[model samples]
Target: MEKQPSSRLGPLEKLRSFKMEKQKSFRLPGSTSFKEKKYKESPGKRGDMMLHLAARAGNLPHVQMLLAEAGEEGAKDLVSKQNLDGETALYIAAEKGHVEVVREILMVSDLQSASTKANSTFDAFHIAAKQGHLNVLKELLNLFPALAITTNSVNATALDTAATQGHVDIVNLLLETDASLARIARNNGKTTLHSAARMGHVEVVKALLNKDPSIGLRTDKKGQTALHMAVKGQNTGMVLELLRPDVSVINIGDNKGNRPLHVATRKANINMVRTLLSVEGIEVNAVNKAGETALAISEKSGSEEISAVLRVAGAVIEQQQPSPHPPNPAKHLKQTVSDIKHDVQSQLKHTRQTEMRVQKIKKRLEKLHIGGLNNAINSNTVVAVLIATVAFAAIFTVPGQFVEQPTPGYTLGQAFVAQNAAFIVFLLFDSLALFISLAVVVVQTSLIVVEQRAKKRMVFVMNKMMWLACLFISVSFISLTYVVVGKDDWWLAWCTMAIGAVIMLTTLGSMCYCIIMHRIEEKSLRNVRRSSTSQSRSTMSISMPSDSELLNSEYKKIYAL
Candidate 1:
């Protein structure tokens, strides 16, 4: 009865009412509908579900159907929405390699506007190229060729992504589309050619250069050309490949002003150095920001191989002098003197020489720091013997829970005199050894204390000696266990004792060695500090003479040095 009134309405009246309702809906607040639109467009689980279904079904028809309704429709427009991670419909399509589906969507009139702001402006093309999907890339490029140079959020173009990932064919396709992409740089100023060269993708690199020859030696943000990354990676084969006849090796410098030679020198690779040096137009005298040449770094490292290589390349090894002037003269100097005196010059030269010496020692110290302690401990045969003795003592004398009573097996004559006497003698010797082992341990500890206090170079050696003592005690305990506890069940007792002895000895020896090495390091650091302090004090105490008293004050400064 209530619906009867509406059923009676004429068709013209119904059409007028429908028009009024549609107009009212359009009149609703922009903020309300816009917010709802944004939410629906957001890439969430729902968006992912639709995409999953579309991809699995390879349903270009459904995707096309959804795309046709985008912008005007609410939920269906979400197909173009960004996910939580900012992946868009196009990104998903390219990732899935759904070429037909991607083409259908791209063909839409609002294709460009449909792109989500959260996405890399380059979108699906970059993802496809990065993932090495050639067919998808061709489809996207066919639709929009300018996407070749379109950048990601990081300003990486599709060509850059392809080159970085070593996607050879994709790189080739992009390069062919826009030959200028070879020169177009990212925010970091790295060109696609730079990425391909660094990754050692020879075919891709050649193709890019063949497209545009000027990018052969372009540099990145740090001023590192493709050659620098190649050398640093120690990709010798790639390095060789990039060394085209026209490649300018010398002109390229990294952030540190280091050419390829500097990298080769630090790597201590003679062959790499030789290869770099052989390059045409390479500079022998080029210095890094530190004013250090390849030869200087090689000398500082004391690497004979690298030094020899540089020397062959006519590298000049410049000697650096220390600063004669005090770091904070007012704090140290009693009086001010004018002018650069002879004493000041001499002091400066001495400081410089000392600095050079310290640098050389530091290089050697690093090598020792890594493995010296372990190697020294293993080499000391006496330390090994001592550790074995201590381990034996622990295993034999440190009594365990007695599971059974000892059962003696011997003839009356042997048992009464020889065997029993031998047991007594063994006991006596074991006691003496235990006492001596304890004494050794005490002595070693005392030595460590002395070294820690004295801050001497010999402290390392002394610490090593202490470790040897601890090892001796540990081995003695292990040996005593095997010798004394095995009167019954000789085989089993001896086996356990042997294993225990080895473990105890090795552990104690290793610890001792580590402690000794650490002490040595401490002593070396202290010596360096002391030397620095003395040098500073000497520089400050002596004043440079004025035009009036040049000889008297200056002579004193010289004499002190």
Candidate 2:
């Protein structure tokens, strides 16, 4: 009597008819299972009430029963589906600390398949980690090993989330797996080490460093290391953790070459500064790229506590002044030529053996026409091409300032005067600075070449160079002022003088700062060398294996592992 199920209603009609027939013959939740409906409906449509229910009722039997009868296809639709906001059931389960539901949802292999993914589509591991659900995390990692590498939509892996949350145990577990701490970066170029140090998670920091001591010195985009972050975070425990022998705190700096000590000075933490100085070879007076030493930083930062620490550490606090210089052209030129010849000869001799070996290889390969040799030649050619390309791009992209701009101010008369003045000044100061820099470079090179021959104290040479830079920059500043004053505009003249004054001060300050820093560094290095010497002498009585044992014992132990 029923119009044969219309062909247009194909699959839908068939499903409905089947359900209706089954309802009469079977006691399914077809149309009359309010209780069952409440339980059987996927967690998405039910809101918080259902989430609570799922947490309470989503046991092995309950889920299995729902899966078996509800045609699971309907349930699969709810895997990642959201009820209100953009959160899926998996997210809800993970966030609510529902371990069983999280596991149940994760177990559905269908979720991993291409078609019906978890409604959240997020790796459940990240959610569990962020929520500090350690057990749930373990289960997820145990079941889905690939989840260790899987990142959420924001490109944060489970390990990253855990580190960010300061969940030490969770981070340790994630670290135990092959989830490389090095490979994980937040949206920033920051690593798990960065997060741990910033959060003052001392145990986590120690655990991370024990895994890879190199990470202790690894830098973020801002060029800050774990030590710098710890100082900035004002975590004394973390700072101590990072000051171990293995930490190598001096290895990194910010964009300005400001080290952890510099940051500590900025933070005005006397205790942190003391802790940092307690390291075996800390450089208290190390100058940054900006030429600001820790003491200078403290003074400039207006932090009295930091200044006191620096003073006690014997950091020099003085405004830099221009140094005196002598002008001698021919003698300096002769020395320079001699030094250049020596260096060139040394470089040539050192490269000679390698060059001869390469030539022999080339000759043999040419005679045989071997494929492997051809590949080597091709690789070398490719490398050469890349190098050439880079060189050309760099050359072409150089700033226009270097090439020259035709300033409207430079008339023929003015040009003539300026050129003559510049030439005269250059002859005086340029030659001197060049000679000094060249001399230092030669000495440093010669010392390296001759294997520390004569060992003329390096501090003396650095100090000499610093003085030369100051003198030369002072001369340059004076010349710049003269040139600027010669221009027509009175305001421009004053501006020029002001700029020269600033440049002169900055350059002189940097030079003196570098000199003082080199002296401090020399002293520190000497102290370390002396301590090592003394220790070696004290331990000299011990036999070979005993010395080895002592050295081995020096390594610090990490506890949070």
Candidate 3:
């Protein structure tokens, strides 16, 4: 009887029951609705958040599970989703050295996109490099070899980051992957060597140099090389390492023209100064942009020991004159010549009565003049030979090397850079230097002029040729720099040219000034001599007593006595 029935409810009864159920599910005026609550607790969003957490915890299993649950499209979204710190699951895993987790996430996600997307500052490869996660780096590089060159937010590549952090193995690996990374600089223009040397990473510096020694020659925005950076630290070993490969960098100047020795002196590092000075070819007296030498800087810093070291190493403080104007060598030379002329004229006028004295004076002047000409000839001969030798060597060892095998556009034994404009200019200038120097050598050796005037004329000709040869050698060196430094560093070559131009132009200007001034003085002296002779002739009777007349008057007085 009780079961008869659970009979179906009528339409009004069903409506009443549905209304009761809806009210029970409904929210108050300020309460959250069912749809809003369901959205707030979405599984996919929670799973993504967990994925980041699990990856950071290095839980490879949990990461895989979360990624699988998100499926293909959803897994990509989850893997790329960044937290408040802009860190993705892959970035965190890589940073934490979770190699398996990195590998797992990379397997499912697009590596190019994931690696390219930086988290806050650095991406996975850079972070792993900075963290010294060698295995993680290997995983990233193995999957995407291009990641080795990918730059972080700071415009630093993985190699730069690793070298800065002193990760030797990581640095070596990255270099092996792409040796050009050693040349890649940061936003600050600091290469991997600069960073390693600055950070006092001796081993890392060694590794970098082993890959490419020329990288040691690279300068930063401040015109500082690896040696310049090395001297700033307390590690003398680092300095030695840099010097071992290229001792030429020992004298390389920074923007302020401060070499390593100068910098060490400024820092009051006596040991460093001693070590640098002990190096062969160290320019102890090298002046800086401010005209301060290492000794000068040490004196200014009040470091007695460093100053003593510098002085002992032949470092002399350049004596700067108090004069506000630059020195004029031409004016000095003219004054010297005029004084010599006046002295000689006065001596001759006073000694004219003594024929033997006049002969002696003439012989003395001739001897001195001949000696000067001999010295000039000797110096010119040495310089000419040196220039000729250097030019000969340069022609044989052409920049960019000669072609070993004949190519479609090349012939055997031809220069690889024969067609390059820079190489051609180098060859032309080098040949000119060689031939000009040879000519000078021939003139000095084959010709022998016994007369003083003839010898002076020959010396002058040789001197001019030597100057021209010197200029050609400088131009040749500058032009060859363009071929050596490559196109990317054309500015470096230009800088070398600018510096060489300044020096050469200054020297040539001074030489030209002296020559012009000497000519003008000689012309004026000749005119003065002509005018004096004319006046003596025109006023011979009205003028004061001549030397003969004075001597005769003295003889008459003596006879009266």
Candidate 4:
């Protein structure tokens, strides 16, 4: 009763065969595996220990087996083994969020001695918190709640690490168990609020401050507070949040004798300056250690926008006095003349650039305007031809048919005089609409083909004529409807006329709305330009695209708490 041979091998057998096979018996010696070969290059040790690799790979069963094979003392030693980086099984498990493995390691390792283990240089709680693993952090804290107060080698507590990485939940958990951990400083004397703001995490910054507002006042090694870091990070949201609790930090100086305003101006951060100016107690005119104010630095940096903002906030620029020890009169006069010539040349060059930019813009607009005009003229020609055909056909086919001329003098439909008046009105309006629309088509075509010199002026004149023709066409359409149904039912005639009026209004309203939005965009662009230096238009920004672009970007410039 022997079994038959299988056609395919199982995975375990395949893997075992792969491990047993050699490259080629004649080529070199028996080849080492890539893992063994790579480890041979390092000589003394493999990269990660088997225990650490099993823990990192989430192999809870293998980890338990390894510990079970080893007796109590041997399993304790295995749990305490470390990799080259000094990270133990618990540390790697905690970092990668392997909860059961971490629990096993914690259960085996001596708790009191393991918290300060020589093999693992870093705190396991800090690693879990920094990596945003709430479950592993909870397990670690449960095993040794005292690890919450322990700082890593870098002197950063779990709370500070969590806040820096934007782990809001982890920070909250650590803070709940040990409320005093919020005030503990990292290596540089900076609190969690400083790290949160520096990392551009507004929610984390607010959360850190909610537990302890005084954390915002603690300065870093650079002698700057959370507001300073927020401004430096160019995070408008974080800056506003930090300043909301304490506006006094707005004027506080750093070790380099730079206030937040000075640093912002040096970096040419226009939004940062705007936020600082928004506060009521901000001293805009206060000078730095160099005896220069934010306005002075902004002026020197050629930031016209920031300078204008500072001036609007009542920042008075100090006037420079002439040197008392003046040079020789003739030498000074010669230097003044040279300076004047240079200024004039710079002004002329800037003016030429401005005119060229304007010409480029006009050319682009002309192309778009001409394209729209051609489309309109083409569509209007089709409509005009249709209207002309209908009008000519109506002249012959009157609403009420003739009755053999009615004895050679009486007009047809004489019994219905009001209906005859309606017919006459329709005929006159229809004729006028046809003629005007036809004329508009001819004029617009001629302007597009031959009239190139006064094209703008001609287009303007043609636009007005096109509107006039549209007005006549609308009136004629309503009159024709009235004539068709005047005697049969006057109510239907009035209803159609009202509907036609509504259609006309809707068409005109769309064009009006576009014009209004464009004007708003123009007004904002003009405001931006107004802050630029009068002596140099080169500093002015390009015109904004549309109202919506301005609205969306408006938040990037300012965010009030």
* Per-model TM-score on C-alpha atoms: 0.48, 0.47, 0.51, 0.49
Cα misplacement distance, residue 84 of candidate 1 (Å): 2.4
**What digit string (tens of lDDT, one per residue) describes model 1 on residues 212-315?**
76666778888888777777665566676677636675457888988888988887887778777877778877888788989999999999888877787788
Across residues 1-561, which tens digit of lDDT does each residue of candidate 2 receive? 355556557879789999988867877445655675675554544453343355445455555555455456755655544544445556666666777776776655343531222345454566678889988777767776667777665566777777767888987898888747446776667777888788877877777878777777667788887777888876788877776746566545788889888888778888888888767677777777777788888888788877876788778655353436675798899989999999988877766765676566555543443333334334433433433344334323322213244556564323334345643573456446555655554444344322222222343344445455545745654554554455465567466657767876786677677556656655675686577777878886311223222222211121000
Candidate lDDT values, in order: 0.63, 0.62, 0.81, 0.73
Candidate 3 clashing pairs, residues 3+ apart or interchain: none
Cα deviation in Å at residue 289, candidate 3? 1.2
lDDT of 4 by residue, 1-561 (tens): 233244244666887776666444434664555776454233225447677788889899988877776668878877776667777778888888999988888888876535643244466777788789999988878878888988876677878878888998988898889889988887888887888888998888878788887777889898988888788777887887887777787888988778888888888999888988887888777776677788889889899999998999888666344557867989988999999999988987886787676666656655665665556556656665665566566556665555555644566644332346666676677677677767766776555454543653555455555555666667766776766775678889889889878888787677667556655765786776565434246755344234344333322222111
Identify the leading candidate in terms of lDDT.
3
Which one wins by TM-score: 1 or 4? 4
Query: What clash count goes with each model?
Result: 34, 5, 0, 0
Ranking by lDDT: 3, 4, 1, 2
What does the lDDT come to for candidate 3?
0.81
TM-score: the better of candidates 2 and 4: 4
TM-score between model 2 and native: 0.47
